[model samples]
Target: MSNLNLSLAMGDYDRTRPIYDGRVKIDGVDPVCMLLSPEEMFFRAFRHQAFDISELSLSSYSISVARGEPHYVAVPIFLSRAFRHTSIYIRTDKGISTPADLRGRRIGIAEYQLSANVWVRGILKDEYGLGAEDIVWVRGGMNTAGRPEKIKVDLPPNVKVEEAPQGATLNAMLAAGEIDGFIGPRAPLCYDEEHPHVGRLFTDSIGAAEDYFRRTAIFPIMHVLGVRRRLADEHPWLPGALLKAFTRSKAMSDAALADTSATKVTMPFVEDNLRRARNLMGNDIWSYGVDQNRKVLETFLGYHYEQGLSPRKVDVNELFHPATLESFSL
Candidate 1:
């Protein structure tokens, strides 16, 4: 039988590199893969259903599922995960020293539905007693102007979100103190350039994240691998095939990271950082699959619904393909 051909789009991360380079192969499939930035990949995926398989934002995916209009059904393979403590940047001059101080302040966000922003808001609500309605959200591009949310959202009446001033970027608004803070997956360029007043709300983000993990054991998931719903329905085995391939690809990356002869990544102190992460989280810190990540998924779903991204709470089981949820064991 001829292998099924499909288009796959995702970020160029270590865990996915093996699949791109042919080190890993999906069973009975021939994939045409493209390495793309999240913004481009996600916008195209959610907006146009451009690829047969792609990485999708968890928050956006939840919203789609809750609305009963999901274009793609997710697999259990989590492609990106991060602690969003470092995602919040604030103007030090605004006297915003803690998460609580963000109340009543104008915060800039590229999109309210971003996974990182959702996680940050959830952390703020859960940890700092700040609700999503407490602050004003100013939405626009991070560095460009007039960026629209890839998916349209009709948030509840209580949530206050406004667009950035005409022709303004969140990066500029944040640097100029037009917005008290900014939260997204990537830091504003002004913050990266070491602008005197632009600093992280959680100055010691590592410490905060470490503490958060210790308490919650959630290294928040940002993106999930998704296959188009029609395709998944047509090929019942595709989701499981994709899951197995991604798992092996991630294992290859994990093995490379642990090799001491030479660092697989272009960073200093690979061994030390790996040891630190394992000590803090566990051996399989960046784990895939549904069973082991239920708590994390449930927490995010709760946050997603509470923040008005999802009309109703989306069950964790509804987030992934059933075939990808489990596997046979010997």
Candidate 2:
């Protein structure tokens, strides 16, 4: 039988490197993997269907799935995960010292539907008694001008959102205090450059993130692997095969990371960080599959619906290929 030819667009992550480099091969498939930034990959995938497989923003994907216009059938392969307590930036001079201080303040964001922003908002609401409707949102680019949301969003009537003033960017708006704070995956240039007044709401973001994880046990999923819906429908075996290859690739990555004999990665403190992460998250710290992460998915889904990103609540099983949901025990 001829092997399937498919285009897979994803990030240049350590876990996915083996798949891209051909060290890990998908069964019955010849993949043409393209390593790309999440911003570029997601936009093209969702808007143009430019690839057969791609990384999808969880928030946007959930919205599409719940609305019954799903362009992709997702797998539980979480390509990107982060604790976004550090995503929230506030003006130190504005009398804002805590998460609760964000209420009624104008918060700049690159997109109303950014996955990281969604997670941040959800965390704030769950941990600090703040919700989307509690703050005024200023929507605009992070560093560049005229940035737009990749996916369309229809916000609830109670939430107030305004477009950035003509030619304004969130980085500039936040620094100038035109907006009281900003929240997104990307840090504002002002914060990066150490602008005096721009500071993270959580000064000890890592500590805060760890505490949140301890309380909630959610690492916060950002991007999910998606296969073209039509392709998934026609080829029942494809999704499972892809998952097997990816899971194998992840195993290789984990093995390399755990091998502290002579650092396998270029990053400083790789050994120490790996040990610390394992200590906190246990073995399989970056695990994939539905059964292992149902609570995390359910929490995110609830947040998606609560924030008006998803028109209605969606179940975790509704997002992935049916074949990928379960496996047989030998």
Candidate 3:
């Protein structure tokens, strides 16, 4: 019997209970600590070599794959929940009204290589003829930049990159007139309202993606759950266990959104959001199944190669094992 002590990382502890509770009951697999973010997961996975990392932020998959470390399972988590749309924030004083107005202005992003960053940039390039060379790019975190060699997209030449703490950095820079606009997931943009210095430019990522996709017919896969390769090779059952757990969690979250009980009274908006998430689980948007996930990774690799992100082309078939998808069957 495999004695697997798995450490899983997530964005929020409260939101991850579905997976935490479900995994504990799996035989031979033990879930240890549930981390709070991708950054923490990366640090712990690399910093502490004690416990084997079983699951972690999907964003970290690219890097983990590069290192050939733990077994990785590509599970779609936040993209289905969050990426249906994204928000762009700009100062009202700048008089920037549309995507076209963003030209020649400084844009703040949470990270340069984040999945959202890549999708947003791709949208700009494909729809508006904007490339990384068109705007000044300011990055929020140092580690947030993904492996350029793994996934390359063309960036504007005039881009200016910087690192700041996730929450306060963008607002501080906007208040000080350091940047003209900001692009990121909706939560950070929404949370910035507390600062009073920044204003929203656009409120929807889905709208932006829709406009872009209408023209391009291509949708970008943002984030995915990554498991280490080593652990996966040792214990094949883990990947299926993870997929089953996440699927259950997704269903529970959906049911919770539909419930009228007082416990769910505060989360009415989440119901519609959950339904949208369920719809996104379709073949086009969600890729929990193995073949579907491989296609997504291959698509990214192709984009990265065409955009000059990687030097020698990588075979998508080699990056992840085929069995990673069998978890959905469990």
Top candidate, metric lDDT: 1
Displacement of residue 4 (Cα, Å) in model 1 is 0.9
What residue runs in model 2 are displaced by over 4 Å at the alpha carbon?
none
lDDT, candidate 3, 1-330, per-residue tens: 556777666554333566666632544666775645555454455445333543443333554454444345454443232332355677667778777888888887765655556556655675568776677767653223321222223443445555454554654576666778777654453344555546665656566655654554444555555556667777776656665566666656545556645446465566566566455444234334545455455656654444434444456554545554343223
For TM-score, the strongest prediction is 1
In the range 217-324, model 2's lDDT, one tens digit per residue, is 889899999999999899988999989989999999999888878888887898888787888888889889999999999999999999998888999999999999
lDDT of 3 at 84: 27
Which lDDT values do the candidates have, in the order given? 0.94, 0.90, 0.54
| Evaluation by lDDT, superior candidate among 1 and 2 | 1
Candidates in descending TM-score order: 1, 2, 3
* Cα lDDT, model 1, residue 193: 97
User: What is the Cα-based lDDT of residue 247 in candidate 2?
Assistant: 94
Off by over 4 Å in 1: none
Question: TM-scores for all candidates?
Answer: 0.99, 0.97, 0.72
Worst 10 residues of 3 by lDDT: 142-151
Query: What is the TM-score of candidate 2?
Result: 0.97
What lDDT would candidate 2 get against the real structure? 0.90
